[model samples]
Target chain A: MTNGKSDLKRLSRGDTENSGGAIWHENFRQAINILRSHKMRSGLLIVGVAIGVTTVLAIVTVMSGLDKRVQQDILSVNKPYLIVSRFDPFAGTKDKRDLMRRKKLTSSDAEAIEDRCPTVDRVDLQVNAEGMMSVLRYGNERTNLIQVMGASHNFGYMFSFSIEKGRFFTKFEQDHKARVIVLGYGPAKDLFPHRGPIGKMIKIGTHRYKVVGTMGSRENIMGSISDNYAIIPYTIYEKDRSSKRDDYQIAITIRDGFTLEKGIEETTALLRKRRGVKPGEENNFYITTSETFKEMLGNITKYIGLVLVVISSIGLMVGGIGVMNIMLISVTERTREVGIRMAVGAKKKDILQQFLIEAVVLTGIGGIMGIILGMFAARGVAMLIHFPYSVPIIWIIIAFVFSSSIGLIFGLYPANKAAGMDPIVALRAE
Target chain B: MLITVKGLKKIYDVGSQRIEAVAGVDLEIGKNEYVSIMGPSGSGKSTLMNILGCLDTPTEGKYYLNGSEVSNLDDDRLAYIRNREIGFVFQTFNLLPRANSLQNVELPLVYAGVSAGKRKRIAMEVLDLVGLVDRAMHRPSELSGGQRQRVAIARALVNNPSIILADEPTGNLDSKTGEELMAVFNKIHESGNTIIMVTHEENVARHSMRILRLRDGKIESDKIIN
Candidate 1:
């Protein structure tokens, strides 16, 4: 019996007082109240569901954050851009020797694309080779071995960057093949520290190039790559290389009204013409866009995501079974109560609704706990792997709906069993 | 007549055995009549009480209550009839263990879709009638045997049904507590509420105005008692 205040006045006059709420509302209140009272039982009951929802949500959130990072940060420097490499930068089946033997491109090819293709916008040439890594130094402070890349002045502006300090070299400095440089994030941090590195000179190989600016950091998907390189003027690169044509790669931008497809087709046709390829032969080059990289990443992770979802679903199924088992035990345990209720005039549907609501409330609470834990899990992993932390709100809603539906789907049998009881037999149960 | 039964029979199938718990019996009572059914163990008194309470349907027979054919109704309609016309009290005090006395009393109104305010007020009325309004908040586990039965009585009275069917209502109570319970029943009866109780105790039966005795699933005797 509840300890409601014994209002002396209302005791004698049954007054047909205004009782409130629908039958289900009462059921819901009672269910929630009881669950709240017995925390440990409900918590244990919902653990399976919580684990399932956590697995799916954490994995999906981390994966989505990585995917977004790949699209906006790593793959596409500026959205709707293309990269023309001599061979596939990401494909795995390529013969390395054959790729090396393919007709190498030069800075002239990048110039030709900029000059001839109507859809081709500004182009930046990258002329780095496999052994271009070198340790940089200034005032006795040094950096780890980092890639040395050479590109046009606008290269820093277009690729994974914003100028953190000062500015990139101008066209005049690039034309003069001046020894000015824009240090990468790692080099700038190591060589400059508190004292700004802008305008200070740093040694790269044998040359001392004045630091014009520093590039902002970019976090690649795999922690392997980083903004740890030094960018020099392309002309200065040519002046230092033994051969000015070191199989260059061109980064191309599409005109405002044109698509990357248009830019790729135009550049391919123009390059094939310049290289004297016959109409039928494949152009001795590969083109990549944001979409291509996304597809490439998708192909690999698609399997992983599928496996995680299947495992999570299995967890949910197990959780649902646990719920059904508990519900069955509850029905058996409350058989006498069920009989008493029937004697007091509760219908079969009323019993069914009571048990069904109980199941839903259980799973629904588990789902909420899972969502909170999953978000925390996602944050932990995102920070662990250096990915931006984000949770897809839609997936949260889906997880909740999915968990409660597990209740609806699996709770049916036990609820039916409870509702189908013969009041006499039930009342007779000990 | 407020109640009537003709040739009512109930046969239960237990695997390979056919047990006729109630075999071909008939009886009747009018509104506001307080009746006691007396019988030894296995006398079909319990079975007949189940039929009258609408907790179970007879295997064969016609039953009329308040001028309507009760035996022919469907499960849902029977539930409605039970809600509106019949209340039941059991030997074990069958109060929902988790619910308080107030909640137990309000349960019938909840099923009847009465709002919370009216339910509380009406349940309080019944609790006061049983002189346990101050114990409204006590759960079954917290109450003594007498107090628990009093809560059960309040629950039976909450809906103000036409008749209260009690099967050995004090079977689990001490004689002193049982006598106290009979006093409550006498008070309800004096207020013109009809009650039919099944008990093997002759002293308990003495509280009722009329007594019907049963044996071997048949009425052995019917008599009016002081």
Candidate 2:
């Protein structure tokens, strides 16, 4: 009876107006209150959705970071340069064996390409120890990161290698077959932590070489294997190994204003004429550009990404099913409330929308938590593996939408059941 | 007539057996009539009340509210009828436990699509009419039994329903609270709103101007107590 007169006076003004907005607001408040009241149950359901979203986002972030790293690695070799190898670097075993049986490319092929090819500006030939692992020794510090490669004096210039300390091997050293090596950044840091690497003696597989220069890192390769190689003059490697059938790789740089296609064509014609290849036969060697290797790496990464998507989709499915089961239980527990709503005249669609919105809101919250968790986890993993850190915005959007849709699809059945209940029977239930 | 039912029957199919909850019941209620239906347990009074309230459909017969045949309407139309024409008051004062009395009273207005400001005004006015304006902000759990019943009555009246149908309105209260509720109902009836209540107690039926005693799903006696 308190404030009775004022209440009646206030109610006299206009009593009829559309209450749809107010009703919707009230329903949402009620749903959130229900979730709050049952904190453990709601938290469990949210964790289910969070786990699914986290799995997908984390895997995608890691894979995307790896893809970017590999692409950068391929691009670091500089442009307008072609790699002519005896075997396709990205090919299967059969093509490699066929190229291996034909004949190992010698230093003569590099010299012929440099002299006769019209578009060629300069060439640097490399000979690597095939399938041989070298253990490097410097006093007491030992490392298995000894990738011993022999190259010409022009190797640093053709590959855009910048010296972090000291200087690259001179042309006189290449002609003299001197045992002078240039350490990559990783080997330089590891082998000479206390002092400068210049004038230091390092052993490569029982052979000794003085460190003349150290090259800084160009790009982060996915694995840390990019900076592990130690380079020496091709004359030194050939004279020491005493091998005639050395499989040599030729790196040709096209002259200014010349296309890579023209360079490849002129090199191909000169090599075929010099080696006496018959007409209508395929070239014995393989030609690869930076773009080709980049595309090939992308394809391989795509397969791995596809497999990861399949695995995460299963996790999402499991999470979606858990959401459905919990929704059903919620409907059963609130049967009396549904009856009360119907008695006051709520239509089937109202009930359906109420539950559907609740489900979406629940999963939406889960999606946000998952994104935060996944990004942090991916950053941690990238740090552990030395891969580049990349933020995948598109994947984040996709994961958010995917998680909410899972709620929409899975929450439909239980919402329908709640809407289809008979008001009389529901009211009669305890 | 505000309500008319002819040869109304409600049959429940329990497995292979059929149970006739309301068997050929005929009744007529005029505007502003204060009527009480008296019956023992299992007398089908509850089923009859459910059918009249539009919460359940009759298996066979005709029911008219304000001269419109509503015997076999669709669920949506029936929901509209329940929201606009009929107001139900359950024995337990079936209020949403989460909502306060004002919000509870505004429920039917919400379904009628009234604006929030108007709903609050009308609900407050109805609460004032029931002399429970102070209790408007109290949830059912916070209010006493008589106060909760007043809130329920306010909810029933807020929408200006054609008929306020109450089943055992005073069944769950102490005798003094029940009589106080009866006094409130007398005042409502005096204000000229039709009301039909079902109760087993004779004293409860004495408050109404007319009484119908039902047994075995049929009317055994009818009388005017003026």
lDDT of 1 by residue, A166-276 (tens): 998898998899999888778888888879898898897788889999977765664535778888988898787535336577888888999888888898899888888
Estimate how well candidate 1 is docked, as a DockQ score: 0.44
> Where is model 1 chain B poorest over a 10-residue stretch in terms of lDDT?
B80-89
Worst 10 residues of 2 chain A by lDDT: A4-13
Over A39-155, each residue of candidate 2 has an lDDT whose tens digit, in order, gives 888899889899889888889989998898777665566655888887786677765556778776777888888888878888989998766557678998877656778899889
TM-score of chain A of each: 0.83, 0.82
Model 2 stretches with alpha carbons more than 4 Å out: A1-23, A73-75, A78-82, A103-124, A133-145, A152-154, A157-162, A170-179, A185-194, A200-210, A216-227, A235-245, A251-280, A309-322, B190-192, B224-226
| lDDT (C-alpha, whole model) for all candidates | 0.83, 0.83
lDDT by residue for model 2 over B1-226, one digit each (tens)?
8899999998989999998888888899999899999988988999999889888899999999999999999888888788777778889888888789998998888777777777887888798888998888888999999999999998887777778899999999999999999998887777767899999999999999899888888888889895
* DockQ of the candidate models in sequence: 0.44, 0.45
lDDT of 2: 0.83
The DockQ-derived docking category for candidate 2 is acceptable
